[model samples]
Target: MSLFTEAFMTALLVGAIAAGIPLLLAGLGEQLSEKAGVLNIGIEGMMLSGAYFGFLIAWKTDSALLGFLGGIGGGMIVAALMALLCVRLGLNQIVIGIALTLGAEGATALLHHVQFSQSYPRLSAPMVFSIPGLSQIPVLGTAFFSREPIVYLSLALVGVFAYLYRRTYWGIALQAAGDKPAALDSAGVNVMLIRSGAVLLTGGLVGLGGAFMAIVGAGIFVPFMTSGQGFIGIVLAMLARGQPIWVLGGAILFGACLSLTTALQVAGVDIPTDVIQMLPFAAVMLVLVFLGRKANLPSALGAAYVRGAR
Candidate 1:
């Protein structure tokens, strides 16, 4: 029998959704932070920290749900440090962000070595939540309807965000906080608080993405297991250009392209391994480069906000 089949395509599609979830969550978080005018380069660190803590907790307790919480906590811990340095003390954003990523990488590796070097631990298969009627629809059923609960939640979040952005005071505050902090400050909204909250929330979402990876995507933890999904997420956020719906679409597209690339390699396409690996990255970049030229990020992005400064 030939390698190509409906089942093979279905498996690839399934893998794509699994890979895309992390990117979508992280991208959404990044977009939120950007909307509040904080360029969050520490997202990679946040994700890595989540993966480590989530994996560790899950391994110890055998509860993926708790592992998710642990991951969120880990991300929040990093976010707090970020807030203290950049938002509170007004440190340089890029410098602090890089430091955070490097710190998390080293710290997580050390912890992993100490705890699981001798005997690597892995989680058992996760329990998935399948939609009843929708799940019975052949190819579409398993690919889109039958999935982990988080997958459905993540998809639903796009609509929720859309509603928030279009019809809520908090969303407007987030937009104002990003576009004109001084204006927001004059309007009696606390600029620093908004930025801090955005960062912390970003950390939580990104961390959840990482935890999902370890608990569901990989089922194991390794040093730097996040690879570059966090960064890819940043790209997706930028490409989405302040639209949550676009973020969702971009993430799934990237994931699908990545899946297709992997399928090509598996089917014995004559591409180099390194080049094949580059498919997802290149595809996302190329598409976004053209479409995102008109993308207007916040003017105040990456700048530390100081009250009453000229």
Candidate 2:
């Protein structure tokens, strides 16, 4: 059997898309939070919480849709706390974010041990939707056109977010909240409300990403399964420079590297698995090193906003 068969290459592309979706969602979510002046370092926690609850719900109920919703709720639960402490009460964002991640790690680990340590289970394969004409194309058809519905929805969100940033009043307000909260407050806009809303939406998107990881990407949930994807998402968002399209491009790039790593392993490359696993991170960092100097972050990101403080 030839290693570089058409089937093998097609599978690699599919794997890339699967791996990229979580990063895309997380990056998009991080972009929204940054736009609202919140540096969400706890995004890892949100994704982990989403994975746990999403998988639990899906396993118990056998419905992927409800699992995804549960995942969203799980992420939002953490985000609400972030908003309350960091946005509403003006706590230290970095400290609170790290604490949240630690809390989530411990809590999910305990829950998984209690529930599934003895009998680890996995879900059935998720349903895939193949486009009529597009699915008929050569290798690209199966690679791009035939995927779970969430894949399509995640891709569409790129366009939706781009529109929100470019052609909407809310976008301007988000920019104001991040760039100049005092000015936005002076204009009678509820800066806190906008920021809080962005945080919550961030959680939802990140949670959905977690759900995709568990329900579709891996078909199972493990504690600490996010494994720094959230942090990578942050890098993607920062390097995107407020462009959703750029986030998409970065996510795809990372995903392609991941796929390449797997392909190398399958082709019997004599490399350490650990070294092979480093490919994606190394590739992303190389991009960062080259382009990060030009990345334009929000001026007020990570700064707490007080209503009237000068």
> What lDDT would each prediction earn against the true structure?
0.87, 0.91
Candidate 1: Cα lDDT at 13: 78
Off by more than 4 A, model 1: 1-4, 261-272, 288-292
Instruction: Please give, for residues 1-310, the per-residue lDDT of candidate 1 as tens digits.
Output: 5666667667667868988898898999899889999889999999999999989888889988889899998888898899889888989999998899999999999999998988888898678999889999876788889898878888888898888888999999999988889999999999999999999999999998899899989999999999888888898898888999999888887787667666665555555557656777787677768764767999899988989997
Tell me the deviation in Å of residue 15 in model 2.
0.9
Q: Report backbone clashes per prediction.
A: 0, 0
lDDT of 2 by residue, 1-310 (tens): 6877776678678778989999999999999999999999999999999999999999999999899999999899999999999999999899999999899989999999999998889999889999999999987899889988989999999999999999999999999999989999999999999999999999999999998899998998898999999999998898899999999998988887767667666666566767756887787678768866766778889999996787
Q: What's the TM-score of every candidate structure? A: 0.94, 0.95
What residue pairs clash in candidate 2, if any at all?
none
lDDT of 2 at 68: 93
Sequence-dependent TM-score of model 1: 0.94
